[model samples]
Target: MVATFGEVVYESSRAFADDEEEECEAQTGLSFEVEHTSVAKSLLEKGSPAAGLVFCAFVGKVAVGFGDGFVNNKSGFDLLAEVCMVGQGENVVDIYLNRPKKKVVAQLYYGAKDKNNPVIFALFNTHGVPRFLANEIVSKVTEFIEVSNRILIFHSDTLAYYQSDERCEGKVFYVASSKYSRANIPSTAVPLAPPNVIGGIGAGVLMHGEMMDKPALLLANYGENELVDSISLQPFAAIVKQGAPDPSSFSLSQIFKQLELTISQSLKSNVNPVAISNLYI
Candidate 1:
């Protein structure tokens, strides 16, 4: 039947065994029937309309799915996970620094970029985008950037250089900042001036540029270094150079496809959908 977020959580909680009961109760405020099972069942069967009202929120688009978290584990079934996408804040910057597909080892070909070099790339997909897409795009972009640069250096932080012309010598540091986007980074001045650690939304976008105010940096929220580590993995570096054109030109769908592949690969070789669903239940 239908269920509100709270009611859904409450029913899910009641379904758990004894030891787990208190934990869910404490966390979700879902307790056993002080009244009766039938009363709770009735409420769960007819959930509030408020749950349906909780759309995507930001873009105001109605969220996909019926507020239920279930998937068939098939081709298009991945879209069902959208329930977890709810209520995410912009505080976390999801970076996809992709490297090129079919990369050569330590050699920069004319058009073949280094798949390892950090570069922002976008992949297009016909389906809507998801978190998993980031992995593929990151791989492709990395390859393209490596081919373009002669001295390839990578660090978790920024680097600098001094430029001496006939007139004078000026120090230029590749400063990283969360304030800039790929579109606007071209206009940014070199030797990024102080106090800002390159990490965040703009930092991921900046990686695509020839010379960044700082090396590609991603400003992440505190206690989330795992996000940084996750992007560093191999699959995330496999960049998708080009994909089918998108109306918005974002190619987010391609990125999502790659991400899904990478994630599916990570979950054990054999995963039973029914068993997995049972775990969630």
Candidate 2:
């Protein structure tokens, strides 16, 4: 039951002028392997939600996310929190389930926006999932739901290249896996520096997409501290809202307010439902 993880001790984002691969330097990282032959079996057997692609987000500061509270409820099995510290040992985690309740193992949610809506099919990561389990959690979770060739990953982290503006006010940048993905990137985002690198779970997803020839976009919103509010989070909402079936129907502020509340509850109330998702629990 032991696991390996790439605990990222030191992460630096290098700057680049053109569209080159990111240059990452991590003092320590988490790495692990698991047997997941039946990982996606539930989604395959039970069916998955409808969506063009997954709009997954990784916000470093928001420990509590919209994905919280979706439990596995396996009778004797202990329910997991979305946020928890993981060491190199046998650990039980959640991943998939019925559509109305599946968000993820740490936070698998279903029936989210169950009504016939624009179909965001969103996935939220509290932050630094890899620090506890490296990208193993992400890699395993990807086995759950299926998506099209295109994937969009939104995350907040420190970008040394943008140290001038700072992570809180730092500009948004994007790194695409292929030329096609780059063309799809919105004009509002800047390109990460040539020598800079994008790390964490998003890095693994993007690289895998590149090798598979799948078009994927990794949008970075630089930030200095753990997320507390939705100050500079608008760009993520903007990109997502812009892609909705009816852009106007999607209220940017509403999502922000939700984000604000989630952060508020985590800080003020000291309750991170994210911890229940197990790995982080």
Candidate 3:
């Protein structure tokens, strides 16, 4: 079934009691239900289109799954949970069991270079799970950008930098609002003059110099921090230095393969599966 933007859905918990077989069956058999919350709906309705749409599920205070995209749908939740389960360190039980108030399970951000650009999504974690999965995504995206013919760093709120490489003359190009100035560039990094033209979109885009085909990478950052965290950037740099997949096409399966994520169990399961590809947005 489909869901509107900001709608919340619930699935039966896998946890069950030893002596309550019938009760467990009843709980497991229950259909997913929408949770009605005025505040959540309001926030979603008012959220910026640039920020994309977010759908999240919580068991008490712990977020079990979350997804983000330009549009909202039920399948995104399943995708979120599938991605959440990909890595080691923290299992599902540990995530749900040790619920702390206001703790986030995962945060997914979807950004597009323009109406025509392919949508790109990034997932962030609050606790428990190691950052290997996030790192893998960053690595793949970084490789794409490095090999592309032209690189543009898109930003809405403030100026951000993409690490320079041989393809771009080891120089940084700016893509920010007209108000952007040299003062906005942080002191820790070498300051380059802002680009003459403000980027039309929020996510960074890489294009072939002659052919304006599909972008090599589309990137967006969401958080309180003014800059994209080093945790996400470091791995991307490491992978690019080691060399990465050629920038011919982008595929979710290829990324999963690169990360060594097993999909058989995820595919077979009804509750949590890789449903990101099915998303309309």
RMSD of each: 25.1, 15.3, 20.0
Instruction: Quote each prediction's TM-score.
Output: 0.19, 0.31, 0.19
Where model 1 places Cα greater than 4 Å from the true spot, the runs are 1-232, 240-250, 269-281
Q: In candidate 3, how many Å is residue 197 off?
A: 14
lDDT of each residue in 1-281, candidate 2, tens digit only: 11112121223222221222122223243232222223222222222222233344442223233323324321111111212121112222234322222233333222222222222222334232223232333344443332322333333332221222222221222322111232243222222222133322222223323333433223222222222223223333444444432322333335444554554465466543222111110
> Candidate 2, after superposition: displacement of residue 170 in Å?
22
Q: Find the number of clashing residue pairs for candidate 1.
A: 38
Worst 10 residues of 2 by lDDT: 74-83
Cα displacement (Å) at residue 279, model 2: 31
lDDT of each: 0.21, 0.29, 0.24
Q: Cα miss at 224, model 1 (Å)?
A: 8.2
Best by lDDT: 2
lDDT of 1 by residue, 70-158 (tens): 23321111121121221112211122212222211111111013222212221111112222322233233332222221211122211
Deviating ranges (above 4 Å) for candidate 3: 1-128, 131-137, 145-147, 155-281
